[model samples]
Structures are given as C-alpha cells and as structure tokens.
Target: MAPKTIIQQESLLQYQCELGEGSLWDAVRQRLYFVDILGCKIFTYEPSTGKHGYQSFDRNVTALALLEDNTGLLAALQDGLAFISFDQLPFPPTNSPSTYKRLNVDITHLEGFNRFNEACVDPSGKRWIVGTMMHEQGFPGSAGGGLYSISKSGDGLTAELLLDQLTVSNGMGWTKYNKTMYFTDSLRKEIGKYDYDIDTGAVSNKVIFSNVDDEELGVPDGMCQDDQYGIWSARWGSGKVIRFTPQGEIDLIVHLPQALNVTSCIFGGPNLDELYVTSAREGTTAEQIKRHPSNGDLFVVKGLGFRGKERTRFQGSFLA
Candidate 1:
C-alpha cells in the first residue's frame, strides 16, 4: 500500500463546547455555523473579521441549514424542526429569547431520550434528509430511531419516514450529480451508499461504502463532500478527519492533536478551501480533559488543495 497523506490542523476558536457536532458553511453570508448538541447552542463565526457568536436554546439544536431566500435558518431541534429568522437574533448572539416558527413534524413518539441528529438539504433544495438517535448512554444497543425526509406540504412542512430501526443515524451527503447518497451509522461503524433520486428524493439500493473495523480509528460521524467528489468524514473517537475517494478508499487523513472526539466538518473560507471541524468534550474524564485541553473546540484544516461546492439551501417555505 502507498503511504497515506497526512495533514495537520489548528484550533479555530477557544470557546469550548460539550458536544460540537454539526458544521455548516454559508457561502453567501461568508460565515461558518456549527452546533453544540449537548450545549443547546448554535454558533456562528466570520473568518474575515474573526467575529464569533452563539445563541442558546432551551433544547438541543442538533443541525441546521440555510434557507434558500437567505432569510434565516432551518434548525433541527430536540423534538422537531423550527425556522429562525436571522434578523430577529442579536448580532453577537445571547441567551435572549428568540422567535421560532415550528414546522409540522410530529416526533413526539421519539421524544424523551431521542433527538434529531445530522441533516442535509437535497441537491434539488426541496427536501431535507435528517436522522434521529438515542442520546442516553448504553443506548446504542437500542435501534428505536429512524431517518426521515422533510419537505413542503401545502402551506406547511411534512416529514416522511425513509428508513427505520437505526441506532445512530449520523452523517449524510450526496454525490456531485445527486445520483448517490452517503449515510453513516456510527455504532455500526459503517458508511452506506444508496441510490439517490434527486427529483423524487428517494433513496434505495443501500450498500456499504466504507466500514471502519479498527477500534482505535473510531467511528464515522458527520461528513461533507468536496468539489472533487471526495467525502471528508470526521472520526468521533480518533481525533481525525479522513478523506475517502468516491471509490470508498482512504486517501488522506487530517489529525487534530488537541481534540479527541472529532464530530463534524465542513468546507468554508473566502475561496471555500478551508475545512472547519468540530469536536466534543462530553463524556471525557478529568484526566482525558487534561490531556486534550482543546477537545471541544472548533478546528480548521487549510492548504489541502481541495475545494467544496456551495451547499444547497432549504427551498421549502416556512410561512403558515
């Protein structure tokens, strides 16, 4: 086997989070957005000005995507989905009460311990694919969660179940042409590729694309695709961001020395050349925390000679 390409990463911010998971880059706003699922916070950072801000929520804000109109954000909260207007938020973001327009998705059945996890808008921008996972410890053995696709239904939104009995539905992404979809089941340590129907938002023909069998390499978490068709996956317990070729072969790995639970990553920057990563400090013992002081901080990997295409924004209307 050929020598693996290695890349080094640096911490982007000093503000640590308990479980930083979702990483998104708003190309139009030129800002990076991420979430601390356990912290119930959504964070925004502007690379040009070095401005960082975050807004706290009463429940877990698992994932989010920009609206097509650029009016605001569509977030996956603990129990359901909500639309949040950017203009209504404080510039520097605070714990102040903000308004939320909840979508019509009844997830009460999965309440209690299960919460929404990773989410991504389809290439058509008309549908959003999201997953749910049990959040409690020792819950991996229970596969009570599922995956759903949310889209516009009349004047409101509707969620349709696509897959069931999922233990931990984590990362999700699409191939350049939208002909294939990639999904991660963390506990299973496998990334599955499926036949994607962009026009109808249908997924089928599931096949294992990459399986991480090494215990030390960790499981796959959140992921994003580059312009060159490479999938960049964050390894949860290994503190690494790995790039997998379209053929599901590992070609590059970015190491984060200050972090252990690497959660998610996205491509951002003025030219979309930088990869922004998120890590978690949750479940870490005091000794582990002492060893990896920046375990929960956001990180960036630059000069990778890779670029990411602009992410599709949610096209569904929020007006009721």
Candidate 2:
C-alpha cells in the first residue's frame, strides 16, 4: 500500500482547488503550509528553499496556525478568526499581526454558508478549529457545525463543542500524551474519539473513531496520526488513503493517483516520515477532471511510522 507520490509540478493552482484542507509543517520556517479553499489562496512551500509562496485572501483561507510568537493565524473567508499581516491582511502572508484579532464563529445553525474548515494546534496551545458548512449549504451539529477551542489567550474563549450536523469539519489528532482528541466529519463517515481536558479546555468522551467507506473512500476529508495510535484518512472520492487503529482497527491502505478526491495529510519532513498530501478537483466531473490529471497536485510518500509536532495555536494567555 505505497504508491502515491506526485509533486511533479504543473498547475492551475492544482486545478482550482474545490477543497484542499490544511497540510501544515512550518516548524519555524522549515516551510510547508497550505489551503486552497476555492482558490482564495495561502500557500507556502519551502522544501529547503525551493521557495514557493503566495498569499491572496479576502476569505477562504481555511487554516494557518503558528503563533508561539511566530505570528500568523488567519482562518477567515467567513466566520472570523483573523490576526493577519503581510502589512494588514489583503494578502499579507508574513508580518502584520502587531495587533489584530477577530474571532467570530458561534452560529447555532442557520447554515447559509458559514465557513471555516479543517484546523489544528492543540496540545495546550489551543486553537482546535472547526466550523463547517456551505459546501453548497450544510449545517452539522445544528450550531451549523462544531469544534472550536481558542485560548492561547486572544480574549475570545469558547473551547470544546465537538460534533454537529456536519458537512466537513475534518481531520485532527493528539494522543502522544496530549490526552486524546481525534476528530473527523467527512460528511459523517465518522471518526471521533475525545477525552481531553488539558487543564480545562474540555473535550469529554466521544467514542466512534472509524466508520468509513464514503462511496469507497471519498468522504473522510483530511487527517493524520500515527506514532503508534494510527489514523490516516483522506478518501474524498476514493483516491484512497486510509489507516485506523486503537481497537477500531483497519490498518493500512495508501493509494492515490487518478486521485478520486483526496484532501489532507500531514507528517512532515526532517523525520516526520514525510507524508504530505492534498488533492481535489473540487466537485470534479470534467470526466472526473480528465481522469485525474493530478487532481489538485501535491503528494509525497515515505510515511510509515509517524512524525508530527509542529503545530501552534493556543496563542492567548499573553505568552503565558
């Protein structure tokens, strides 16, 4: 189960990304950050200075976290979570958070396209993001969707409300003693297991970590986790990428090419086993986008063990 490695390069921004969740790994500039939510853009890849950076935003940023004083936490295109810079946020991919913080998502379900999808940064740095709907209209937990925990101290604290009506509030994991918090809602293919408290951030008991097959792997958006507690899901339309464990067991299967839909994967370079993948032709069917012409590019292979820990968010306690 190892034959999905394509970074061959060639793009229309990898074919107008319909959804290319977060593929993070910016361990302080080692470089690799992503999001193409409808091509609103915010991508940076520095595979050792092959240097590729682009930032264009007005909303559709999806996710971007790094603020242990690194400053750059913008997840907006709708439901608010801003602290951007590049000079003040029209598309400031770098410096511009001298002071800017807007956290606006707690909608309780009207679901007229409330957005914000796929996020990470937990392990006491809090910023476990999720608020999803509007993939053509959705509303999962009734709150239009759930999952929000922002408290590194930016002032807007509403942490822990982890499941709802559901369209796609995807892939997240933390259990190397981070106390356990695994999540995914790829149209409810189901993948959940929570029992975290991290001194009161709260995420109590929610077991059901694997109930997939989304028309044959095209329903579990994004995910990453495997140091020993495996769970790697990305089967958008069955381009395939699966691995599950912790007694819900369904061990391995990684095969992407002609990418059915694939979107999200992380296990960075420099010993993270390097498994970075993100793909999508957003609602494909130009003959499945010409039978998968790298359906939204970017892929890598060499992941077997597990290699994470480069996530940052909780940035609030004023550097507490």
TM-score for candidate 2, please give it. Answer: 0.32
Cα lDDT listed for each candidate: 0.84, 0.65
Q: Show where candidate 1 strays beyond 4 Å.
A: 3-9, 106-113, 135-142
Query: Could you say which candidate leads in TM-score?
Result: 1
- Worst-scoring 10-residue span by lDDT in model 2: 3-12
Candidate 1, residues 247-270, lDDT tens digits: the string is: 888888888878889999999999
Estimated TM-score per prediction? 0.94, 0.32
Off by over 4 Å in 2: 1-20, 23-41, 44-63, 66-71, 74-84, 88-118, 121-182, 185-190, 195-199, 202-206, 223-234, 237-259, 264-290, 297-320
Each prediction's RMSD to truth:
2.0, 17.9
Q: How many residue pairs clash in each candidate?
A: 0, 22
Instruction: Write model 2 residue lDDT over 112-169, tens digit each, in one string.
Output: 4467777777777755555555444444334355566654334554545555555667
